[model samples]
Target: MGKSQLMEKHPTGKVQVRAALLPLVLGAALALSGCIADPQPGPTDGGNAAVSTSAPATGELPTTSAPLETTNASNKAPVYWVGRSNDDFFLYREFRDVPDQENPVTSALRAMMSEEPLDPDFFTPWQNPKELATSISGKNVITVDVSADAFNSNLDADTADRAIQQLVFTATAAGASAGLIDSNQQLQVVVLVDGHTGYLGFDHIRLGAPMSRSTGMVAPVWIIDPQEGTELPEGVVKINGRSTSPGNKLRWRILRVEGNSDKTSYLSGEVTASADPSQSGIFALSVNLGPGKYELRVSRILSTQGDSEVNVDSRGFVVR
Candidate 1:
């Protein structure tokens, strides 16, 4: 069958076609894979109906945002979403609170499929499956059984590849974060549709094989702390995040959100992320500001002459 005719067989083919054409029409501003940026405001709290305010006691899994302060918990688990940086589509992660009873891996996948990311710029194309489950073998292989309905979204080859990695990254992160798997060992994921193998994923990629994280799939830079829509007391607000390729230095800026969409630069500087070969690029800085909405942006310095930067990551916050 022809590409267009083949796509038409899927329920969401038209929507996927529009999404694929968006980047061509809007250029870098709307660059993305099958995932499209959300236009709405406010935190989604993952797929959870409500966010709880009470903190879970020590030694217990936190199900609410209350423990965020004392425990320094970002999100209950890491859920990867697709987004664009430097005009290229890549996977970005957001720590999110999943349901209390749900397994970390399952919850993360569920959230990735159904929930909206806190940042409006990030999104996912996976649909929520009616049934989902995960099991980890001693060999560090994670088996994911998801209902076939989760593959409802039609995607092109590139987006399909990214979508698969989204699952791999999220499952492994969840497993390691929850102590269900050894972080020191190599891990792989095998996806099964409706508990059966050999199911085609998004009508593009063949499934039921051992899959590992693909290099160059993740965003080169990502804001890790003071997540989008965070409200902080006036003081020295700490800004920290991860960078995959922190050459020599990274640039940062704080822009105050003035009127509706206007942003006035409040602070700008250069910072260095850790250069340790054994660890990913980690950087931190602190800035004090008065009560208002602000954005923290970071980027890799590509060149010293003129203005050349790439792989930007930013987050919006409120200084209370």
Candidate 2:
């Protein structure tokens, strides 16, 4: 009788251990899901798109672009030198002068806003055209990775959310532009701690948007097809765009071919970042183009990754 009781107790202990581990396992999966989100905007010939010309005038309908983000160390006015009279005054710039809508790092900074439900139809959506994330911290099939420093340098969780809102408000003032974000994008905001993937508790700020006062979390996504220049059949080519990051769900278009100085043609498209960094998304096109001496253009909407000129990968094959 004693032996049987002992055996039963052993199994019970094992069950207890597993039960305790269940929440841990679930938590790990949930945390990883956040880091693996994807999406972003931009990839154009514009050299280093610093400020977007898309902001609306002071008070207008609503445009797509927003005003730039800035940081003010002080709240004093009439910053001036040793004025000869009181009239010799210095110029005082606002806390945030230009919008933080072009660089990946800055985009992440701006994304801090919108934690709560935002006006779905206003603003350019993502901050910049190009993303400034790492290689891959994928989810499902969509892959992406962004730097954590980008978020930390800008603002804390409490402030990040408001910053993003500022971007939306400024962008829509002159009348927000539509069609910047497509329907096929997803989003994710990963917040790294000290350089390693950390927990997503209120401990740190999220890489993307803001949430309600108590509710805190993120948006993630993953792309499953047309993997970065994946060649399709000859006659029927399926070309589309999506954010590998959890946050990037905007439209994807070929942003003119990269490194094609010889070919004087424009094969361009627009790409948006949803959850992930916009830089990771690859926007491409496919058509019933009969194989011949044709140039393969690798396009980017807002990126500085490849050579400035349009690039053409020479390929020849038959359709039939």
Candidate 3:
């Protein structure tokens, strides 16, 4: 068969090309499904402590602390951010100090427009959409009102699509994190220009409809735990993250990156990390290492495609 086309055109002259969803790669990325318990037994002294490499026989992750306590770094709400690698944009998360009672969806959007991303690789195509206003109407639809100046045309069609997606993803993420919406229900977002719902997105994609996240729009893997540049007093650290691949276990590796060189000392071999069978949940692993800068890479082969690193997440950190 000929190549299939997924395209949409705006009333003006812009085109939105919806990329086809890549087949789910088995055991791909971080399949976060369980709770992160306190750092398990590992060598804290100068001796290299062997990290726990075994997954408990029970598929159910160890339960500890209340759901509220599960929130990373206090009760700060989660705000999704957009990171670009090559020509693709992937979704990332960052916590904000905004109170849980406050409208975190709005707070997150404002932050997305105002602050620079903490991740150096991530960036936004936004220029601080002016006078941004957000609200929830009807049951679970989020509406964002902004001026035309927010629709800067400095980006190409693809980048602009990701930018708009960033807004939809962040809004829903904030809403869910703030307890304003339920996971069993659907949440959607619509953009309005100066009180009208027919505004154009950065790339001229029509913003009149309520947008929902689709499988093709997200990064295959993400490292949600031990935020980048985190300084840990202990050598043992718990790593957590989320993924889309369906499998019982994923692969992980820890490497001591040589300064200003291509060389790296492999601390952990091809270790397997247990994942929740539900696809996206907390996947935890305990690792012990001496004080130094290290890079952690979690990856999986594309079961759908040929053998290759289809989805991977790498984080760099320092131990003191």
- Cα-based RMSD of the predictions, in order? 11.9, 24.0, 7.9
Q: Rate the local accuracy (lDDT) of all candidates.
A: 0.66, 0.24, 0.59
Q: What does the lDDT come to for candidate 3?
A: 0.59
Positional deviation of 272 in candidate 2, in angstroms?
17
Give the higher-lDDT candidate: 2 or 3: 3
Question: lDDT for model 2, on a 0 to 1 scale?
Answer: 0.24
Candidate 3 lDDT over residue span 1-320, tens digit each: 00012234546543343443323222223333432223334333464655554342224442211011122335565655655322345666767566344366777887776666655545555556667778886578888887777665345566567678778877877777666666456677888888887666774588878887644455556677777677776557777765454343445666665667454645543433344443344466677777877777766555455645645667778788
- lDDT tens readout by residue for model 1, 1-320: 11232123345343252134213211111110010111122222222111111111112121210001112234488888888775556777778888868777898899998887898877676877899999999999999999988878767777777789889988988887777887766788999998888998989888999998766676767788889899998656777666654234567777778769798766676665443432334456555566778898887777665557777888999977
- Superposed Cα RMSD, model 2: 24.0
Off by over 4 Å in 2: 1-228, 242-261, 264-286, 292-320
> Model 1: what TM-score?
0.77
Stretches of model 1 off by over 4 angstroms after superposition:
1-75
lDDT tens digits, residue span 256-276, model 2: 233453333323333333222
lDDT (Cα, 0-100) at 221 in candidate 2: 18
Best by the TM-score measure:
1
Ranking 1 against 2 by TM-score, winner: 1
When sorted by lDDT, best at the front, the candidate numbers are 1, 3, 2
Q: Give Cα distance to truth, residue 82, candidate 1, Å.
A: 0.4
